[model samples]
Target: MKLSDLIAQFITDQLTGQDAVELQRSQLASRFGCAPSQINYVIETRFSPARGFSVESRRGGGGYIRIVRVPMGPSALLQHTVAALGEQVDQSGAQLLLYDLHKAGILGDECFCALKACLGDQALSAVPQPLRPRLRAEMLGAALAALAAEQ
Candidate 1:
């Protein structure tokens, strides 16, 4: 695993069986033998709302970062995924989002594969290259929103 992945896993382990965990950046940085910015990078990317986490930080008195795992049902995950989609998404980005949703047990095997196929380049062939990514984002957001509505 990469250093970032290790750091992410460590933080995750710390949160196991708990709703939230707090840590000092300097301590985590020293433990990981990296800079505090490195810890920040992991927390920012791996513990984002899209991944079902919310982080809060304090800036004084040897500040600490609090990571809270957001409790979410399948519908909630679907809704969050849709909201996380920005104005555009490449094929890989859509795949990663779908994979995350699937791994969370919100999407079954059939649904995951089907969604991935639809988001692939071939599926969007009719869309001009320049417009494909934006179209994919719109398509995905709409699909997820529709699913969320049903749930």
Candidate 2:
């Protein structure tokens, strides 16, 4: 593995439980003798849904980067959901799925809120429209998986 890849693995290894929170990207970059952007690149390229991992980032001071490993069951579900999303997702179907997940207690209120924010019509009204549904699905799936793994 490359140095950055090894460093990323080490960081991932350190996250043992759900309560394990975000890691400082700058700190990780310094530890690996790389730029912060390099760390971001590594995360974007290597820690992806297909690889069974998801990453969340924040900007500005005290910001952090979170990497969550998706459990096998949810990972499979997410894969299937992504495949099923195809080009677009009807709003009603997305809402229904979200409702089902919320009802099942698989997604908590906070997660539900975040997912809604991402999938809300206003948030998705932008260029490259075809990508929104798939992105929302992927984000919701990852967020749910993270919540499940954490609990």
Candidate 3:
């Protein structure tokens, strides 16, 4: 596994049976023999709201990073996710959201993979480059909204 993956796993382990975990950034970096930025990268990519996590951080000598696993019902999760999204969503962001839904048991493996591919870059390749992200966001928003309504 990659260093980032290992770091992410370590942090996730700390959250087992707990809603949240707090760590000093420098200390975590020291434990992994990496820079503080490495910890930040892992937290940003792995613990984002799209993955059902929310993070808070304080910077300074006494600073710490807090990763909170959000527990939400399927319908609520879908609604919250749609609300959290911006005007555009890249393929990776959409995948993150799909993965979160799958993890929450809201989406089956086949459905998740299907949606991922449907919203993927290659599927949108014929569209104009600048327009694809916008179209992707609209498509996902509608799909999630419909899913929420079904719940």
Q: What is the C-alpha lDDT of each candidate?
A: 0.87, 0.65, 0.88
lDDT pick, better of 2 and 3: 3
lDDT of 2 by residue, 1-151 (tens): 8987787677767766663447898888888888898888777555554445666789788889887776555546455445434454545546655665565455679876777667776777883667766666666556655655565
Alpha-carbon shift of residue 10 in model 3 (angstroms):
2.8
Model 2 C-alpha lDDT versus the unseen true structure: 0.65
- What are the root-mean-square deviations of the candidates from the true structure over C-alphas? 4.0, 11.8, 3.0
lDDT by residue for model 1 (1-151), tens: 8999999999999999999999999999999899989999898668865578878899776799999988897788778767767799999878877887787777789988999999999999988999999999999999899888988
Order of quality (lDDT): 3, 1, 2
- For model 2, state the Cα shift of residue 142 in Å: 18
Stretches > 4 Å off in candidate 1: 14-45, 48-50, 54-67
Task: Score candidate 1 by TM-score against the native.
Answer: 0.70
Worst 10 residues of 1 by lDDT: 44-53
Q: Residue 146 error for model 3, in Å?
A: 1.8
> Which sections of candidate 3 miss by over 4 Å?
35-37, 57-64
Better of 1 and 3 by lDDT: 3
Q: Mark the regions of model 2 whose C-alpha exceeds 4 Å error after superposition.
A: 17-21, 74-151
Clashing pairs in 1: none
In model 1, state the lDDT of residue 28. Answer: 91
After TM-score superposition, the amount by which residue 79's alpha carbon in candidate 3 deviates from its true location, in angstroms, is 2.1
The better candidate by TM-score, 1 or 3, is: 3
